[model samples]
Target: MGNKNTIIWIIVVVIIIILGVVVVGNRKAQAPANVQNQTQEESTAEEESLPNNEVLPIGNNQSEGSANTDTQVSSTAIVTYTDEGFSPSTLEIKLGDSVMFVNESSGGMWVASGPHPTHTLLPSFDQKKTVQTGGTYTYTFTQAGEWPFHNHVKSSEFGKVIVK
Candidate 1:
């Protein structure tokens, strides 16, 4: 009878050990997923904190024909979009200058380089995303030419930028 009791205790101890190992293994497997979720949450928080019209510059800083040859300067040009259409339907800017497209209309605006449907003209100039009302997307003119762009949401609304 004593041996039977001892055997029972040993089985119980073995079961407890197995459960501990299983719990630890499961936690280990889920650790990476938890970390990934935390990173995504942090990224979303950062993007949300930024203002809708935040000016984010993208491209090289060097500009041609500056007063200070050693120093580089870039300028920003604003083109506001309204219900009627782009306020400045035509704009002229120099290379390395950035143009900020602000959406002032009631709906979202998708700024993309035109000949509609396919934004193959100056593909890099496309915003590739929808700019909500009051939001803005800035693109630096790198190449010199007459680049036409339009609101993908309302293709009828169009504009042009002549870069020198």
Candidate 2:
């Protein structure tokens, strides 16, 4: 009888431990919900702030506005994303000018200014913000340099925006 009681007690302890682990795991998963909500809110606000959103064509690799060699900055530029990759693979924008990276791809695209995996070239310009088909992500250039960027999912496809 004593041995049987000891075995039953051990089984009960194991079950309690398992239940504790499952509860903790669930809490960990829910923790990110709050953070995700905040990020979505911020992104929505940024999109709302921009004006005159021009819808560029899919696979259109043309600069939305004419490249200005002089100091005059183009008001806004749209770079479309398709299976071929970012349109206008190379773009030139003036300081304080905004570039809208619009995704018209079938799946999500991760756009980040980079030197490959680490997007440290222009840290402020990097975003893991996944743009679903028809979604847009915009960034204003504050620094003057050639900022190379790539689709984090498809690294082979790359592009750069030259800020002058």
Candidate 3:
């Protein structure tokens, strides 16, 4: 009878330990769910506080007076170089626009410039396209600012893109 009682007590202790482990695990799992719920509630509250009628302007050549007009203009421009550098060293485009560079030189030599070296376009902009003689390269601008770029091959030959 004594041995039987000891075994029963041991079984009960084991069961209690298993139950405690399960409870702790359940609480740990529920903690992430609680955090997710709180995050979702905060996100919903933030969205509700934002203005509902806010709209972004689209198209090109947007001036103060032409803000309400629906006349859509092409925000893209083309810059071609045949002899030395870009035809228009100083270019003007909309805030969100793109420029295509066409290499018309005969030899395998082409480059462009901005506020800095054009080779830095890698890891920032699309520089995969190399302007090899007849090759063409295109770059798009999404941010608003004055960017000066220059060709790594020829630092003297540079250009500037004014984003308005």
Candidate 4:
């Protein structure tokens, strides 16, 4: 009788551990989907609020208007992303001009100013969130320099923006 009771307790403990693992695995899988959904919803809200040609400042350092004191957007440029990485690998734009990073790849892209990981070089250039495929992110160059950028997810791929 004692042996049978001990075996039952052990089985119950094993079952509990298995349940915990399964529950954790399920949550882990759902987390990314939940975040993605939330991001999409927020993006929709932002788009609805702003006009087609308008863009709000991106990061903490960026202000309400263009980087320059003029408070006007000079122009807009495009940088496309595919499996091969950013095309027009090196772009040259004037100050107060914006570069729109368009993701045309199979997966998401997190475009950020490099030295990678830290993204300290041009902090305002960081996208903060992943730009899903077919999505776009634009950053106006407030400062002029050779700004190197990369996909935070795929650090191996990179490009540079020459702001004049």
> Could you give candidate 3's per-residue lDDT for residues 1-164 as a string of tens digits?
99999999999999999999999989988998899898888877767654332222322234533753322333568877666777787799886678877777553334443334435543345344355777876777776677666554545666777777
lDDT by residue (tens digit), candidate 2, 9-99: 9999988999888988778777777678788887876676543242333213234333332334647889998989999999998888888
Q: What is the C-alpha RMSD of each candidate to the true structure, in Å?
A: 21.2, 28.1, 19.3, 28.6
Which candidate has the top score in TM-score? 1
TM-score of each: 0.58, 0.54, 0.47, 0.56
Worst 10 residues of 1 by lDDT: 55-64
Q: Which candidate would rank higher by TM-score, 2 or 4? A: 4
lDDT values for all models: 0.85, 0.81, 0.65, 0.87
Q: List candidate 1 stretches off by more than 4 Å.
A: 1-66, 69-71
Backbone clash pairs for candidate 2 read none
Residue pairs of candidate 4 with colliding backbone atoms = none
Higher-scoring candidate on lDDT, 1 or 2: 1
Please report how far candidate 2 places residue 110 from its true position, in Å: 1.2
Model 3, CA-based lDDT: 0.65
77 Cα displacement, candidate 3 (Å) = 0.4
Ten-residue region with minimum lDDT total, candidate 4? 52-61
